[model samples]
Target: MAKKLGLKQKYQMMTRGLGWDTTYQSMDKVYPFDKFEGIKVHDWDAWEDPFRLTMDSYWKLQAEKERKLYAVIDSFAQNNGHLGISDPRYLNAVKLFIQGVSPLEYMAHRHFAHVARNIRGIGPAVAAQMQSLDELRHAQTQIHTISHYNKFFDGIHEWRHMHDRVWYLSVPKSFFDDAVTAGPFEFLTAISFSFEYLLTNLLFVPFMSGAAYNGDLATVTFGFSAQSDESRHMTLGLEVIKFLLEQDEANVPIIQRWLDKWFWRGYRLLTLVAMMMDYLLPKKIMSWQEAWEMYYEEAGGALFQDLARYGIKEPMSAAVARKEKNRLSSEAWAIFYQYTHAAAFHTWDIDEEHKAWLAEKYPETFDKLYRPRLDFWEKEAAAGRRFYNNALPQLCTVCQIPMGFTEPDDPTTICFRESEYKGEHYHFCSDGCKGIFDNEPEKYVQSWLPVHQIFQGNCGGASVEDVLKWYRMNLGADNLDFSGSPEDKFWSEWHRTASRAEAAE
Candidate 1:
């Protein structure tokens, strides 16, 4: 070889020289979508990608990761790995992954594609392009890794339809829809900064750790593979935040506002995940409170300190979020326990051992605020009358969760906020949601509230069964109480046969 090119020079050669000016066509006409958002970008050349990833290296490394991931997935299937899980209940975590999270990967891919096309800078555009490819890979790998479970599990089939039509699934769907529909700068701040940099570890780490703890080889493999890509995404997120802040002093307030809005939005969405980690996993890895403290409170606190130099402060609801972490998972599990009949996933009464675990994890609030209610329900379930809230629940206008969250301060009383816009009443679960609604009334007013659609004769018919049918639910299998369900019966028989074989041996 005559000479070897350095990484920085290669990146510059690949990215910088790809743009040119035209005397006949103005740059504004060429890049019309970038300017209208009131964002002041003084110098596009200042945008930098920290990863220094070129397309050739990106493809080579990604292909190697895929080869190894597929090898593990193949091994898992050949080894009858489903039987090796800690418990059948652990599959519920994977079910939620397929139904709730996998589609979001696809949505991220779409929005990042938009950003890559519309954003003006060469460096940022290249980074967005890489992230777009990463997201698409994540979606495919997640589906492929979990498809093995679909062969033997309920609630996993028809997940694509459920993601769009279900009541609870609306939480995540609405979140991404709001972000993708926003302007480019807002989308970057909302997703790249607020979601990826600030909150992604909270979402990804627990689920992956739970999978590893529960002997889910395929999910663990896929999770690690996706996480490798997430490190790059996190770098992109931090770079974009700093770039936007460094671009103009005026960009600070706008970014802070987006941070506040998306942080709360992402936190509310993660409540479902918190419940999954604490209540759904058979072999608990860590309590949701511990994970929150480790991921968000500790790491996120330091991040805000670093950003403080740039005039960025913590989100407005940071205090409330910290306080609520103690009770968030318990309250969320209680809602799911009661309304699981309307859900595709399964839930059952918490046994005494599990209750003891909860008490230890949430000593301050479990018995005082949440346990009494769970105890009463446990008693009712013992008497052969499992509780299921059949009536529709009012969803918050912005977050779209049921109006079941307690007041931030009291934790005993339900936190319900209402606003009147153009003589129309809109409901919210908390002050944060209410503030978001008040700021963006017109956008939220057009929300496709699932419960409201049921009452409007728009979602199937007025009956719960009709709506379930429309949701593509597998009745007596996917929905209703998990006690004595087919899955429970299968687990019982599986263990009994194993015992017999061991005794015979």
Candidate 2:
């Protein structure tokens, strides 16, 4: 036999063997999507495999992980891990995950599969194929992990249905929808580069840490399972960017524009995570402002500096986002508080204890700006007049967020950016969103705005109640304040009965 193959040699030989130039058809025909976006690649062979993982070895490693992961899941379920959480309110964050975030994993699966088929190089295509499988596994594992909570929780049961049509959910849904609809190169830049590389810690770390801090053993276990795959995906993100930049000098500006567009897009999409970290998790990991500073401000600053060698500067929205971080979570939470009557998950009416936390975390803004607003709502709730705004708010033509974000300079005034597309005036939440719309007016104009759809009699009916019914959400059980909801009452009753049993024993 020939000399036993070493690891790198095995990887190169095996990966290269996976793809061959088509005999019956030219590569232009086989990989039609490679050139349409104007991403010039002179040689497909230039793509260096980031990780040397073969399919057979990948399956074996993943199988072992799955076995360990399920054992932990079974143990958690048998131990009634749902009851062991820091608080019932903490599950609202979990509800948000299942409802808004988990479904994106499945979408990644579909599109990565598409990328694998359409990319020219064997190295990158094989990498994409593995990531597609990784995404599918993540989606399945998240459902299985969170399904334990569904037995007791109200909002999670209809995640897939709600992800497709719910008003607030359309934020993430639209983000991915735009990505998947783009050409393959743009998809890689958007999801793999911008999302997975630049902004993933903002999404993943906080959620995982919140689970651990909140006594969520099951979800923590799932996080442990996904850590390796997330690293691999992030590595692929960097590799894809560097590889594209090295291929052609002209691809630099094209890639830079994509970086700009997607940074803002990914930032807007992460508004949910900001709200979750600040408002939803009772035992908070860190304030959203702090996390942003640590993750994006410092870490991302360093990343962009590295890319400067390739003439890739930081995104245009970086300074704007840094300014808005001081205000992001507060504004996002305020919208949820106002619209909690129609929301699938419950939001608490901010009490003094919670207000104190907000004050401490957001000293500069909370006391001056957001505190008085919460005090008004708190006083109303105490006077048997809880404020609940059920009316649909105007949505940005691009980001789909309620038109609530304020000027970067002035936190008190609503920041509105407007553009006229083909004689029709459209609105945006920020310069970033307006810029996105200005670039692709045709695509942005066709956005499936839920508020607009509600007006046009498309989403179940004319009223919020009818729309909620169409969303398959139980009105009282799912919506309104978490403090005195049925879930809260049941938690107290269950614990009291358990206490009595222990006392007798």
Best by lDDT: 2
lDDT of 1 at 370: 76
Q: How far is 500's C-alpha from truth in model 2 (Å)?
A: 3.2
Q: Report lDDT (CA) for all predictions.
A: 0.88, 0.91
TM-score for each candidate, following the candidate numbering: 0.97, 0.98
| Model 1, C-alpha of 303: deviation from truth (Å) | 1.2
Candidate 1 TM-score to native: 0.97
What global local distance difference test value does model 2 have?
Answer: 0.91
Off by over 4 Å in 2: 1-5
The digit string of per-residue lDDT tens for model 2 on 171-271 reads 99999999999999999999999999999999999999999999998888888899999999999999999999998999999999899999999999888
Q: Write the per-residue lDDT of candidate 1 for residues 1-505, one digit (tens) a residue.
A: 3286787777777777665565788878877888877888988898776777788899999999999999999999987678788988888878888888899999999999989888778888888888999999999999999999888778999999999999999989999999998898899888888888888988888888889899998899999898878988888888999999999999999888888899899999999889988899988988888988898899999999999999999988988888898888888887888888888889988888998998999999988887788889888989988888867788899999988888888898889889999999999998788888898899999999999999889889988899999999989999877787788888788778777877999
Q: List candidate 1 stretches off by more than 4 Å.
A: 1-4, 22-24, 496-505
Output the TM-score of candidate 2. Answer: 0.98
- Assess the local accuracy of residue 96 in candidate 2 as a C-alpha lDDT between 0 and 100: 91
